[model samples]
Target chain A: MSCGSSPFGALADDTRRAVLSLLSEHGELTVTQIAEQFTHIGRTAVSMQLRVLRDAGLVKERRAGKYRYYSLRVEPVHEVISFLNSLYGASLDGLARAAEASADQEPAAASDAPDPTGTDKDTPRWGISY
Target chain B: MGNLVLSQQRHLALPPADVFALLGSDRTAGWLFGADYQALRVGALVQFELPLNPDDPNGSTVDAFGRIASLTPPHRLVIDQQSPWVGRLICTLTPVSGGRGTVVRLGVEVPEDAVTWLLRQRGYDPLEEPTPPATVRIGVLTSKSGPASVFAAATENLARMAAAEVNADGGVAGTGHKVHVVLRDDASKPEVGAVQFRRMVAVEGCRAVVTNVTSEVFDAVAPLARRLGALLIYTPVNEGGRFRPGVMRLGERPRGQLRLALPTLVREAGGKRCYLVGNDYVWPRTTNRVARAEIERIGGVVVGEQYRALGTTRFDDLIEDIAAAGADLIVSTFVGSDEARFERQSYAAGLRDTTRTLSLAFDESTREFTGDDAARGVWTTFNYFQELGSDGNTAFLRRYRATFGATAPPLSSITESVYEAIHMLAASGALNTDANLTELVSAVRAQRFSPTWPSAQPEQRRTGEKALYLAESIPGGFRISAN
Candidate 1:
């Protein structure tokens, strides 16, 4: 399953997003780990929702005997990162300036990075050390 | 000593009207000296070394160092400085009639410094010389107040001292006239600089104009100098690309300077990704674009970039977001006043040690404003030293302290340019020996000033080259890394 492809996939519920957020932050979580904050819904509903998350590729599940845990998938994580990047396209501009002070204008001249600890990093106008 | 004037040098007698136009050139306030200095005649070889602030020993930013080539006659001059930042300005001065007065039209050079530096640093060199009175007028159009005032303001005082000393000496031709600096406050706004530039010419009757500034402000005054028949001496650049024919830009361009700071930081943290932070303005945004282009070129990735408008003082949310991104480095471009607040907040948010900030335009003046704590270990670059171990710098500080009653902040290459502009003009003036615009213009094109040279002012000299210095914030204050 993919984002926006499920019958509930097209549905972007606040409760469902909260579940994904918890799983992402904590890596993998059991039903109890996810249900702790979703007091509005009981454990059974969260378990069912976890099943939905797994179906949408937004999460994955692993069973350790008595308990089952859910983890965020790298694909969806990458997708979210892309979305966030597009949303905040203007970040890093301020930060890149820190590097701008020293060799700020010189882009990489070749396919490789310059020696990270080379004292002559600034020797070439087109050289890059990072 | 104060009323000395020059006797003729080349046995040239001027017609009454032509002489009046030349002498009365003083009425044209703010006249800038360009390549074809109205005062410089044909066949003058100015043998002067480009004066730098002399601080770049740690591979820091190097700017505005070169040697004078030749001052040919009748609107043509050639220089031997190997600066890629300048596009080999083939300035041609043509004097025309404007509003019943003569106008000196000019042409200029605009090139990327990286290319120039690449050529020179890789063994590219130029050779030449001549001896003609290439009369020039040195003008300074620096911001005296407002946002960008701090960087270029001290340049005025340094120019004053430099000009005074240069003129008191035998002048450029070892003659008698002294140099006079026509100062104005740009208010750090392009519009204001534009208006002030006009006033400096129309009202002040300044022969030449000198200024260190951004493109916006340089754009405002570049054409006006041509119209009024003055020379335009450009000093210490913020960004490149503003070379008009009549304009002689004398400073390190942006790319050459930025090349000094990048690459090293990218590898220090061992991550291929970066986040950029800077003032949401042309300089920083352009810097971001270049960095990302460079990063991608090197196989590294730009994780992200962020910008805040000019006066933002908050960073809590921004810091949290950066930490979440897990970037190895967070680059910064926040200049002057904004720098302190950003660092304090970045540290408070637990992102300080996680990231290192490198800045441009945060010099000693900035350190004074931000204090030693907020900027500790924060690195920046320039061509002068407020904290370097140099006798020349020591003398500069002593004079400034005596004059202003307190030590002046670090004078960067731009500020030093201001000082050099004034003295160079005075030297040129010594040959013709006049105070008005035309002679002032001639005085500059013919003169040279150094950061550590000796003169009548006891504070200035004709040292040939200016060097770059790099310093980082340490305990007592910012210390020179390689010094």
Candidate 2:
């Protein structure tokens, strides 16, 4: 999903994230089965969390003979990954352009600047602070 | 210009053609509860039997006659119903994008002017002509002449008193508008209540409505109010588990009332073996479930339980059964005149001498009808009693007596609840003619005003929270015991 459409807001809770993890490990599980795995919470609470996840389009539900089976939808996760990739790719392109501009002006300022490798002693190359 | 409109939409997982076939073909009888209709075409007539009250199993059925006003194959169907109530129905079907499903929309509309004319012809005019701009109309729905009328004896009188009191005090807060009260008698029928509720909203332009009737009538009107975006303040003593948007119940719940009443009955009155009896309906059934649990919790044995239909007057056989069971206590949940008949017949059967009776439905007006001899020694528990000794109650009684004079209807919990409801509306800033549902509901939930008589304490859910009192019937009225 796009950043605005991501289910991360629903997964922010630890219990909901655990529910997602459980559904990912197991193919499909009913509300009773999912609730049985938790010791501190109750079936109603788990079902409510599942409802939130369902409303967020992070899970799909099916009915089979009085039982409801819930399974995770992977398309939203793929969309979230694509959104992250695009965001990081844009940042990397900006960094590459900055490096090229520095290289083009290196010869003109070679005598003035001692560091020919385009590395400033005070600044880290990875653009990260300690 | 006013029209009552009802619209409902649903999505089916079948194609549009399949859905249309189900709506148009004779096969619809199977799913529509055996409805009989002519072929789907313009000018065709359709007849069906719809339940008078869905909440009542034994309720009567009325015939619905409709003529096809327009027809478009598998796409749209418009039918006009011209019996009991005047209304037009339209159904539309559209295919979904996937071509495997369909969206269906059903709508019903009734012209308010025709309904108002019909009501006036029946000697009931719940709407007024050309409401003044500076007046806030509040609709009052109650049973004025029916089987349940005994319970709502003072509802209209008390509501009028409250309105007058509010208008005397400079009208509603923030808005200097006088209150105009519109009264409608549901006649203890859910169908009637539903139609009246629509008329009040669509024609009278009521900002809010106060309903004091049976749970069945409330059930029928609540959904319509929600659909019409009308604010409904339900005041009654029934099963009391209903919660919805724009609907607030400010009455005693079965669990809360029984929790206090049953345990006290078992301990103080020595009620070891208990029997249950009530009208056969959803409210009685659900309430008895809670009463049964509470009786069991208090170390009492339930000897027998029985239910009779509403308006059932003869109780000789039921009284004989209660006597045969030799139960020490009878927890009667009957409402209105049915309750009076049971009490009087039980007294005549001499069951009153050996067995004590605790009624959840017993109030001052019902007690008056039950007679002094029959009601004597009978016990009841409720949130409000007219004899309550409080500064607020004394002043309220004095003002009520002064306004209505000596021959007024006796004040009871049901009536006082309606009285309290009007004040609650004013206190919550819901008396404004322009208030919306969200604003009114939120104001009611956040309200904590104390009326002259305290029932339940103010809470967010609109359920009353007050100290319950147990009283014994005296010659003409109840002698409330110290709590």
Q: Pick the candidate with the highest TM-score.
A: 2
The number of the candidate with the highest lDDT is 2
- Model 1: per-residue Cα lDDT over B298-382, one tens digit each: 6777777888765465777777878888777666767544666677677666665666566666666556445456667566666
Instruction: Please list, in the order the candidates appear, how each scores on TM-score for chain B only.
Output: 0.60, 0.72
Candidate 2 C-alpha lDDT tens digits along B219-338: 898898878888888877867665789888877788887776776676655668999999888788888888889888878889999999877879999999999998988898898878
- Name model 1 segments beyond 4 Å from true: A1-130, B1-139, B170-175, B297-299, B311-321, B428-466
Per-residue lDDT of candidate 1, residues A1-130 (tens digit): 1123311121244467567656645778898978888868999999887787677566777889998878876554233223222211211111112222222223331112232211111110111121
TM-score, model 2, chain B versus true chain B? 0.72
DockQ per candidate: 0.01, 0.01
RMSD of 1: 31.9
Model 2 earns a TM-score of 0.58
